[model samples]
Target chain A: MKKVIVHVTLKEGVLDPQGQTIETSLHSLGFTEVEEVRTGKTIELLLDNHDNVEARVQDMCTKLLANPVIEDYRVNVEEAVQS
Target chain B: MKKVIVHVTLKEGVLDPQGQTIETSLHSLGFTEVEEVRTGKTIELLLDNHDNVEARVQDMCTKLLANPVIEDYRVNVEEAVQS
Candidate 1:
């Protein structure tokens, strides 16, 4: 099996209210050293071993996993370690 | 400066409805080889250079970034590359 990890993050310059809120909260909590925060999504997928897995996974990201207009995604494919 | 990446993921055995929905959607989209899916949060933080930054980041995770009861988090601290 192949393990695919897709990270979807907002494009730079996009307003991330959630991140801003987190930063404010952290400051209030005494973590004043924190300067900036950006939040994103991490999706982990297990797939059957197959050819062209990376390409297929990229297509998945383009079609559904990420919103291309405002967000960017990176896909990492690795050998699934059996438990 | 430090670039801290916190990855918060649901504990193993926890039900992930969002992941299930994504898996179903992928199948319908003809990505039939997909077997399982899990979703998580990725928080990226930029912090001022300071002593004990890793410990501070871990505290941030415990206090605000992650729910220890149902989620596990990993922190990666790297030197912030200047633009």
Candidate 2:
């Protein structure tokens, strides 16, 4: 089995209100060390054999996991390594 | 500045309905390669400076980002590298 990790992040220049809220809250809490914050999603999957793990996962990202108009996704595949 | 990446994932044995839905959808869509799927949150913070970056981010994770009762979090802090 293989483990598929997908990271979906906001594209540059896209507005992220949630991130802005976190920044303000952090500053209010005296954590003025922050400039900005961007929220994202991580989807992990355990899968059987696939012809091309990366490509298949990327297809998933484009088809469902991420919004291509505003988000970019990165895919990482690793052996499940069950022990 | 530093970019703080916090990954919040469900603890083992915790049920993930969203992930399960995605899996089922994927399989129904003829991509039966996946056996299981887990969904999580990724928070990216662009910060100025905090004496100890990792500790501060982890604190945020425990305090607001993740529920210790059912989720585990990992923190990764890197230089902002403004160009």
Candidate 3:
């Protein structure tokens, strides 16, 4: 099985309310210097084949992994080298 | 500026309690079949220079971005091509 990693984040020019919440929460917990924070999502799926991995994963992201209106996604495919 | 993107997730062999919690939360929100919901963090930083970008971001990930005990991280450095 190989691992397909997906990252979903707000596009550069967009505003991130979720990230703002996290930043405030962190500061409340005494992590003040975390000057800026943007929150995003990461997903990992183990698949059996490598053929068309990138295309397939991109489809997944566009369809279910991210909200295209405010977010963008990146995908990385890595082989599971060991057990 | 360069964007240093960090991805932090539970290492493969370890259990993911937080993921489990999110999965349950998803189910409670009426999204059942959303079977393995693993949550991780993604951070974006804007840097003016590209020199030592990888090293600098890795330091950030290790120092504050992720919990090393249960999570592993990956970094991507991308140049901000235009205004």
Best model number under DockQ: 1
TM-score for chain A, prediction 2: 0.91
The lDDT of model 1 is 0.94
Model 1 is docked with a DockQ of 0.91
Q: Each candidate's TM vs. the true structure? A: 0.96, 0.91, 0.57
lDDT of 1 at A17: 94
TM-score of 2: 0.91
Q: What is the i-RMS of every prediction?
A: 0.7, 1.2, 5.7
TM-score of chain B of each: 0.94, 0.91, 0.74
| Reference contact recovery of candidate 1 | 0.93
lDDT of 1 by residue, A1-83 (tens): 88899999999999999999999999999999988999999999999887899999999999999999999999999777573
Best to worst by DockQ, what's the order? 1, 2, 3
Q: Which ten residues in a row are the worst by lDDT in model 2 chain B?
A: B74-83
Tell me which of candidates 2 and 3 scores higher on lDDT: 2
In candidate 1, which residue pairs clash? none
Which residue runs of candidate 2 sit more than 4 Å off their true CA positions? none
Q: What is the CAPRI rating of model 3's predicted complex?
A: acceptable
Candidate 2 residue lDDT tens string, B35-80: 8999998888887766888887777777677899999988887766
Query: Per-residue CA lDDT of candidate 2, range A1-83, in tens?
Result: 88989988999999999888887887887777777788988899898877788888888888888899999989988776472
